[model samples]
Target: MTQPIFKDMLVLELASVLAGPSVGQFFAELGARVLKVENAATHGDVTRSWKLKAEPADTDTSAYFCAANWGKASLALNLTEPEQLQQLYTLVAQADVVIASYKPGDAERLQVNYEVLQCINPRLIYGHITGYGPDDARAGYDAVVQAESGFMYLNGDPGGEPLKMPVALMDILTAHQLKEGLLVALLQRERTGQGQLVQVSLLQAAVSALANQATNYLVAGQEPQRMGSEHPNIVPYGSVYTCRCGGKLVLAIGDDRQFRKLCAILGAESIAIDPKYKTNYERVQHRQELNQMLHQLIAQQDRGPLLQQLHAQHVPVGAVYTIPEVFAQPQARQLLLQHPGSKPGLRQVAFRLQGQQELDLSPPPTYDNYLS
Candidate 1:
């Protein structure tokens, strides 16, 4: 079997919550040795306390905590204390990378900032995450960043109040950004033999991920509004319909051909031939009427047969799935990682290298195992 990459690398994770830890886990998944340094005074990472009602209150691990932290050892330290700070510095002297998410001045105050740590190990790559930027002191929260970054504004129903996403989307996006930056820094280190600071702010990451939505405004002067699940540029895309059996599915008919195929399958070939619905542009212009007609036709058939027919026609469609239904799929079940005593966790490293075998990783660590 091919060995996992980064097996000899060492990473020190000084971040809490999602973004930084998720990056650490990414490296850990690639076979790096990651040490998660949590706040001793706080009893460890903050997410350890973010448990659901069904979770045990006495434990330091939570479902939220397990979401990003995997394949790593835990170390709880009071960084404000001189001795504990020295311990971290000792580790930094031999570390390859350090992941941190402290607010602007907190790391400096604790003397664990990149400036100080880089002095101990000139070749150490330091990855930092911030709320705004290096100059901003405000703490970053995912929901608040989602609102500030225009995501909340573009979400939700047309006339309803703006809604935050179900997951910590900004944090996840920031984590991915930092991962890419750190990987580039690593590649650069191979040439220069020196490490540099890699930084990402939640605000910037969110805005950068705006993708085509940002272009719709900047290039086309279209200020995007909440259209629920609808796409601004595509008609019949993101339209949801319920079948006679009450199962719901979403459509993503991209081009005129797919739309025509959909119409043919629904026995609405006349609609496909109509001048107003002949092309994607015209269909987009008359989307309200087209969607209404499609919805009614779809609601007449059973979902299973309709999905099979659509799949055979190469039309992009997906059934709306609940959490349980999602996990029930073979693909989703294959990604699950089972630890001996803890709740099952999903793998964060979704991409596999060619010829790479399944990774042998440890479960997310508990404070009791490493708090000394």
Candidate 2:
């Protein structure tokens, strides 16, 4: 039997919504015993109410809440109550890590601040997630950070109204950063026997996620523009074209050879000979023209036959799959698990350690009895 990573480690999740809970969920997936603390006065996590159209309006369970709070026990407590605060203090004394998404000064007021918790348990790893920084009190909404951090500017079509990502990208990145920070803190405590404060903000995560786009602006003095399913650096990448069957196919032609092969497979070898489309750099420079040419060609043909040719030549082609189409896939089914009382098509935490992917499935807790 393979032992889980961070087995028996305790995580006190004082966070809510997506970011902090995401970190806790990752820890839980990694074998930590995570206890999610919700505010007794509120509707627990705000996401508990972020229901979709098909979900039961009367139920507290939600896709948004379930997405990040799996495999954790929930406890709702009022910080104002002395007995409840003492109960939390006892829990903190036993916990190895605490994750919080409180606004600027709220942590200190709630008495879950790092200084206080570390005093109670010197080995406690404290993590904080916020909108901008410790001094900024603004709430961290995904679209706001996406817009503020230049991420939105880099998304969507070049001339269309700048669009925010469909998913909570900034929060997701913040979770990854928090997870990394906590792991590092745990490692540091193992060596130095001292814990430290770790902080990550949505703005920081958004800016950092720019990757090469940030580099282009910072190092080369070039602002990134929206490309709309097109690659900024490579040509023919993200070039989606509709087929005769009304299905969409995307060609991911990275290098010159791949482009030449695609051209040959499409019986448009003249495209490969053209100076504007001969090399990767040339193709990038003439992306619009090249894509227009490929789009017309691919659009005229059926997706099935075109994809068969592309795959035979190994041109890295893929059919654009809708969400339902994605879930219907066999591989997607293998990645899914039967989580009770929530969504029917539940996905397992994405990790494949030693060819073993699924964890011991546990439903998210009902935080109902905690306040009572």
Candidate 3:
């Protein structure tokens, strides 16, 4: 295994849940000495118990916690205690980076705000991750941020009620942004020899990730709606057909040529030759009729042959895969997404380093009980 990237860098992580811990996880994976500070009485991060009911045991075997907390050292400390606070301060005085996820005023109340810590060590890169922001008093949550950032509006059926994604997308996006901020601050410190405060808000991250949807609204003055797995400007850009094997295919045709090829592959070249479906605009306008025609032909067909045919035709298509199918699938397995490990067994995830391969570190620390 290659050496860790931040092998000599010290990171003080006070973040809990996803956003803050995710940043720490990236740094730790890159060889940073990440010290995760948590309070024992409060049961540390609540994610340690957020397992689904079907999981073996709910106690401390939390997938959510383990997903973001891997590759870091845990130090349970009560900030309310003077001795613990002193030790934390000592850590802060030596740390190159400090990540916190407290609410607007909570950091100040706990005396972990950037200003307080910067006084102790002027070179400390302090990162603040919040829901709405430290500016607005609006409370933050995945669902709330999803709604506020217009993410909920673009998901789900066109006429149906807007909905947030199943996962905490905002937190994950904010974590990525926090990682970028940390890297930029590290680079800046290299030049100025001074550290600065970095901020990442869930709302800002969500809005930024809206991409073309936000641009459409701003430039075209269009109110985007949930299209129910359909593309706004492209025909055949959604679910193609349900297979006999219970699989499904989603097809996206970038231009009229691909659409023509798709029709030819389906043995329906007459549809492409028709004047009404000659252009992309016309095809998009007649998407429902085209989808109905394709669905009728592909309904009983198996996915394997259909995918093979589509690949031969150079059509952009994919089989809809379940989460379990994703890991067991060929491409995912080839990417080394699943790493072999002992204790709990197989761990699946991508690595942080650009060229480094995945390494199975020791099993999760038994923080509640001392490590054996």
Candidate 4:
């Protein structure tokens, strides 16, 4: 594959927080020259303060900030100022793409709305990330959107509190949605010699993420119920058993063969042969009974040997890990990164292009050392 797919493109980012910045960051990683513009007078992106606490090996940069803006250039200009606003317009004239996530009406106030900018740069691919609809002024943070879009109610245990995901999953989904739209826009621009608007919202992203659950409700009239770690339609597909050594492990058996094999290994072949627990649909219908019986059988086996046995059979299984444990894995170490002379660690690019990989982890801007 060619190196730096967006090598010659310039992206002007007028967004903050996760979704909008994430879109720009992805393009930057793919080789776009991204200039992150923040209002000089404000604190800038909200995520800069989203850090809980500084790590000991701190570069005085927020850990959250490093996750998205590692390799981008930064320039601060208060858009309210006439000269600075004109400078931004000039930048937009030169940029191949422009992205923003300001609340509804803020773009028009700042003179960076798609209608306004598209007139200046005919080929500029513009992306807008919003919390709700373009005109909705409600705050569109992930948890809030999760609650609004029926996503939160599908998480956690059935009888327990409806849970929100710890990470900004809605925002992440919206970012991916925006990225997909922009890529398509870029391709279309290549053909038509014109750019178009790409818009995504956290509310819409949450609805899109409903994936199977939405279909289940639409097709079968089955409202999704939270099953904790368990999959609603898949039987024996969660951490359902405690080993003899007292450690818990997930047992992700999909097909009938895997289920039969699992039952055979547990010395409970009768369960697999039973008409009520034979096929996936039947097993899902009787999951509670199946889990109870397997739980008892699984307790007879040692954790180490049980895991090894599952691995030998190629059944999907794993022990849950804490955050520190997750990063301690060998795969995690390979992706850890640090900027030159910076003392803290950050996550490197998620993957590499086929061509030359630029491992530049330039520390996120300090505001004082603004990018040219």
Candidate 5:
């Protein structure tokens, strides 16, 4: 088979934590030559020891570090040194893309901003991932960005204070947006023969990811609420119960037709046609009552059988899966999501070769190897 795209693209990754490196990893998977640039004295990336405490050299064993640094080469240098800075400039001259996830003022202070790099390579696609906007000086983390961007307000339980999403969603979203911005910059460079700064902020990404929610609030003056796995305006479109062998199965009914089918399958046709539950709006209003009724009826169902029956009905229903359960799932197996390998000293995740002939699953580099 032919090699994947970007086999010749050289990417310089100067990102830490999630935002910058996540984007670099995606590119690395597509056959880009990605070099993770970090400072020699400091920890290579904050995620190195993000989970459990470990010795300085043991970071390669961290799943947190493995997630972002896979399929890339690591190079450490102290830019404060004139020689190292010149080396980086030389790298920039050769690179097709440069990504940095630094504090707001760090780039300008270091004199490694896009403008400086552009002087070295006019065609370089420079991407910056920040916590806040280019002008904001506030310390931006995922939580802070989520709150500032109005995304936190839409999460969590109803009537509760605004809560941020459980994961580093802002950073992750920013990473993807950075990838998109890089692609756009590449296209623009192709036309104008000039490189440009592509900046993506976590706050901006959070707002962008809100999609229809943001529009609805702006147009209808309806502050989005925390529905807790339930749709805000759709009824019978949320969680339901089905009884089978001994336990209950949660069913999700998205439309009136699906609800009608569910009712038929459960032999509860009256509930589907009842005037109080006839319309989607009416069903939404009486969600509590409906849930209660379905919960009672579904208490005797087995989860396995309910899932099979629902799949046959073509209803978009599913049981909530745990993290480990998802990895063990048959569909996940088909996708080849699991990486199997050993780190030199400690075990680390191997990058799965997605129908590709070559696999780059080397463990995070050591201090000496990182500096090279």
Candidate 6:
């Protein structure tokens, strides 16, 4: 069997919570040896205590903590203690990369900043995540960053209260951005024999992911408002319809041809050729009317049959699934990783490479499992 891409890499995770740990997990999933250092004074990562009401209070690990912490060994240390801090320095001297999520000044305060670590290992890539940026002192939280980055402003139903996404979207986005930056830094190191710091903030990452919505405001002078699952530019796209079977489905008719196909399946062939909804632009202008017609037609059909027909005809339609329903699909099941004693978790690395095989990764570690 072929070896994984990062088989010889060593990642030292000095970060807690989602973003930084997730980046570490990405490397871990690619076969890097990741060692996560947690605070002994605080009994490790704060997420270890972030449990659901149903979770056992006595355990050190929580479902939230396990989310981004698979395939790693854990070392608990008090950085304030010289002996413990020295151990970290020893590890830093040998690590290829260090992932940190310290606030603006905390890393410097702990003497683990890039400047200090660089002196220890010149080829070490340091990836840092913050709530805002290096200039900002406020602690970064995902929900707050979502609000500051304009995501909360543009999410949710029109005229309703702004809602943060169900997941830590800002943290997740920051992780992906940091991962890309770190990968580039590694490549640069290959060329120059030197590593540099890669920094990403949750706020900036969220703003960068705005994509077309930001352009709608910047180029067109149209400030986006909450439309609740509806895309501003495309009609019949992102609109959810409830069927007679009480199941909800969403449509993403990108082109006029697909729109026509969708209308034909709904038994509204006349609407497919209608001038008002013939093209996407015209349909956008008459979104309410077009959507109302489609809603009525869809409400009369069974969801399973309608979805099957849409799939067979190449119309982009999907059932709106709950979390459990999502995992019930075979495709979703294939992404799962089940350790011997822990609950199954999703693999962070989703992309496939040639001749890649399934990884046998260790479970998320218990506190200071490496010490034990």
RMSD of each: 1.0, 1.9, 2.7, 2.3, 3.7, 0.9
Evaluated against the true structure, the overall lDDT of model 1 is: 0.92
What is the per-residue lDDT of model 6 for residues 22-59, given as tens digits with 9 covering 90 to 100? 99999999999999999999999999999999999997
Q: What's each prediction's TM-score? A: 0.98, 0.95, 0.91, 0.93, 0.89, 0.98
Clashes of 6: 0
Query: Compared with the true structure, what per-residue lDDT tens digits does model 4 show for residues 164-262?
Result: 988888988998888889989999998999999998888998899898889999998998888898888798887467888888788888799998888
For candidate 6, the 10 contiguous residues with the lowest summed lDDT are 363-372
lDDT tens digits, residue span 59-107, model 3 = 5747677767766678888887888788899889899999999889988
- What digit string (tens of lDDT, one per residue) describes model 5 on residues 88-182? 99899999999997778888888898888888888888999877778986656988888878778777677887887877888888887888899
Model 1: per-residue lDDT, tens digit, 249-357? 9999899899889999999999989999898888879988988998899999999999999999999999999999999999999888887876788888888798777
Error in Å for residue 215 of model 2? 1.7
Clash count for each candidate, listed in order shown? 0, 0, 0, 0, 4, 0
Worst 10 residues of 1 by lDDT: 355-364
Off by over 4 Å in 4: 54-60, 343-353, 356-358
lDDT of 2 by residue, 119-181 (tens): 999999999999998989998898899899987877788789888889988998998888889
Clashing pairs in 4: none
Q: Rate the local accuracy (lDDT) of all candidates.
A: 0.92, 0.85, 0.80, 0.82, 0.75, 0.93
Candidate 4, residue 230: lDDT: 87
Better of 2 and 5 by lDDT: 2
- Name the runs in model 5 displaced over 4 angstroms: 53-57, 160-162, 238-250, 334-340, 343-360
Which predicted model would earn the best lDDT? Answer: 6
